[model samples]
Target: MKHDRPKISDVARLAGVSTATVSRALSAPERVSEETRAAVQQAVEATGYRLNLAARNLRHRRTGGIVALVPNLANPFFSQILSGIASVLGPAGYNLLIADTRTADAQTLLDYAEPSRADGLIILDGTLPATALQGRVPVVEACEWVPGLPAPRVKIDNRAAAGLAIGHLADLGHRRIGHVAGPRGNVLTEARLSGTAEALAARGLPFPEEHLYPGDFSLDSGREAARIWLDQPAATRPTALFLASDAMACGFIGEVQRHGLRVPGDLSVVGFDDIELVAHISPPLTTIRQPRTEIGRAAAERMLACLKGETREADTVLPVELILRASTGPAPA
Candidate 1:
């Protein structure tokens, strides 16, 4: 037996709405009321009606795809952000294409921005030059952003977030604070480093050059930082350290424990990007919680706006929270 598939008219009839309303409800949900959307959904479920997305995209001259450029696809911090992006774009009938720019050159990365490839782009790599993305497809920068690119960026205030970390430590009676900074030439690294300095200055605290350690936001760099801290004379060591990333903080804590050390008892540690792993560590990490998923969602919304020819001149800055955990405590007596 052969049965013809249900059409949009069938769905409209079942929902007691016009075919035009059904089309708008399915394709651009925001254009319709909540009750209408619910009715359309029920009608769709009852009639087993499916949209012909391929044909619709062909008629509209759209590729039905959105590309996201991530610096490191393996990093857990980015997982939630990517999930958020997918949550929105998927239901909107757009395919998400994630490209890792970790080892890609400028020219190679630029190729992904062509309009023929995808309808829009979501860039999370801040290291790319402004020239690479200037006149290409519509873009929304998430988490990280190029300095001079004329695109809407969705991120937290890195400087203020760093200040929160420093303020927390200072309130806990820790006078001499140390910082594990990210690599040079990175925008986040620069912002956070400057924030650390500004916070210290505001409190009239001394940040000796030796208290600053170089890192590349990796577990290995954290381990190396632990070694450097351990080598310093006991009397001159800072009472607490604020690491640039949670992975690095975890690595430093693990390495320090291996060499017979107690967190918060002998030394306290704070980290950024409250990733999931931090909560389960030996001494749960105290860190700055970035709204990673929200950042992604906001970025996707901005991309959609750009596609609709809407202009957003201001950047979106989300709020961050300082989560207190066992990894941080008052300065040792």
Candidate 2:
């Protein structure tokens, strides 16, 4: 004959704690003392107790999971953000489901917004139309967002952050600075481009429209911008550059070297997004740190609130900081 399964009451009895205390230990251990938690854990191991997640989910009428919809899974920038999100949600016993928009077909992509798939959603793609997310599940926008989207947003002040990047370049005495722009239609690209323009004007620096090169915020785009600079006369080409993303800045730097140009000695460059790769690259990149971990944690919190029928604020904009590194220096004499 099969042995009977251990129950919650058995665990509580073994631990010498009330059933409520046992539940609390499993659900919110932080609310209990360390000694109490240890006893409950010991009781669980002794009784061979395991949580019945299916039964709990059935009773609560909820899936114990949330989905994060990222535009690109390959981009390392999203990795830290996802880690931060997991750190917050995991402690609460919620599973994280990663949905990569790039891999999904148009038909399957919209399924992410469906409430039936997960309890909530954290959308990191700004280009998706607001109408696409009209499902019943609560939604939070992180890193990027589309205007008029009703969901809560947790991100940095992109325009101001971009302005900070450019201001740093200006302070270095580089009046004739070039910019590697992001994709044309992206909200980030628009905000950063406008901010760069404003910063240049405020500094009373030169910004020839021709110097505003088109880029897709990719390594190839960065290399192309560098090639265009190479085509220009050495005396007229800008002494400094402010790339839209660290990936692009790194590409530009590598290509410039391949073409026999010295960074800082020949060209000073500043990049946006202080990604990990930026720090390890030769002559580390000076960039605006977006606090990816903070943004991710905040987004998870906001989503949790929304799921609880709370009315969260429209947007929470975190501050950005400029990280000075070996990539930037005083303008060439």
Candidate 3:
């Protein structure tokens, strides 16, 4: 009761053609004579032969797969990005492997290009060394990038986007503004922090040396920043604070409330990365909205182009939008 499956050899024999002719007919039918193609079709139907893509790819030395590595997979910020990547790769018959790199070492990143692993990689982390990425497999950096490393990248103009936040606060008549920047040594931290300072100076405003706080783009860091702000006397404390992320903004607002300070009342606040939760919080966060999904889709497409041996510029910068919501208001009277 065991039935054998039909193969390409059987189809070629039935069509009275050589195996090479059969392959050309199936893969590049336009190149074959119409009569040969028609004969191959008839033979294919008669023998019920289905092409084996795995076998063909094996012979071609292709794994038909790619990989995506992110700094933290558990973070909700990366969900839409990964979705965008799959949308493109799925239709092209390529499989995607998501790699969580919070614990990845230098060797782990370097080993991504080894044989039988993946054809290419899309890296979301920006801190990896350039030495770890020199390999035959292609790599594309998305959202964040390490300075001085040469790699194709898709990201927003961080400095200009941060400037927009500062300009908004200034427009609201806030002379005393503080900034909670991302981790030190991070490219984003340098860009946004410099942008904040530059925007302040452009408006004839001065930044107190002690007003800037270092944050790791985490909720806990935001809470700690609020405490530091509170330690200052009310007269010297900044009336407005611009945090690097929505999660931090939410934490700052929550922590300040515990000290009987209300957002936009006792202290006006602004945040970056207008995540969905920011809109539903007690006071909606007024922040810059990054096109996270767009960045991912563009990165995926760019990676595909690289795999085809196409060369591209090192940077692709996207625009950002500032959303004004309830969290920010006119400086307190």
**Top model number, lDDT:** 1
For all candidates in order, the CA lDDT equals: 0.92, 0.87, 0.87
The parts of candidate 3 lying over 4 Å away from their true place are 1-53
Q: Rank the candidates by lDDT, best first.
A: 1, 2, 3
lDDT of 2 by residue, 1-333 (tens): 998999999999999999999988997788899999999999999999998876777777888889998988989889989999999998777899998877777666567666557788898988777777755688899988877778898988888987898888888888798888999989899999888888888888888977888898788899889899899888888889888899899999999999887888889999998899899887889999989999999999988788778986668999999999998888899
For model 3, the local distance difference test gives: 0.87
lDDT of 1 by residue, 1-333 (tens): 999999999999999999999999988899999999999999999999989999889988888999999988888989999999998888778889998897778777778777778899898989888887777789999988899998998999999999999999999998999999998889999999999999999998899999999998999999999999999997888889999999899999999999999998989999999999999998999999999989988998888889899998999999999999999999999
lDDT of 3 by residue, 11-100 (tens): 999999998999999866878999999999999999999888788769868787888888888777788888888888876657888888
Candidate 2: Cα lDDT at 108: 67
Backbone clash count, each prediction separately: 0, 0, 0
TM-score of 2: 0.91
lDDT of 3 at 291: 88
> 52, model 2: CA deviation in Å?
1.8
Q: Is candidate 1 or candidate 2 better by lDDT?
A: 1
Question: Compared to the true structure, candidate 1 yields what TM-score?
Answer: 0.94
- Considering summed lDDT, which 10 consecutive residues are worst modelled in model 3? 127-136
lDDT of 1: 0.92
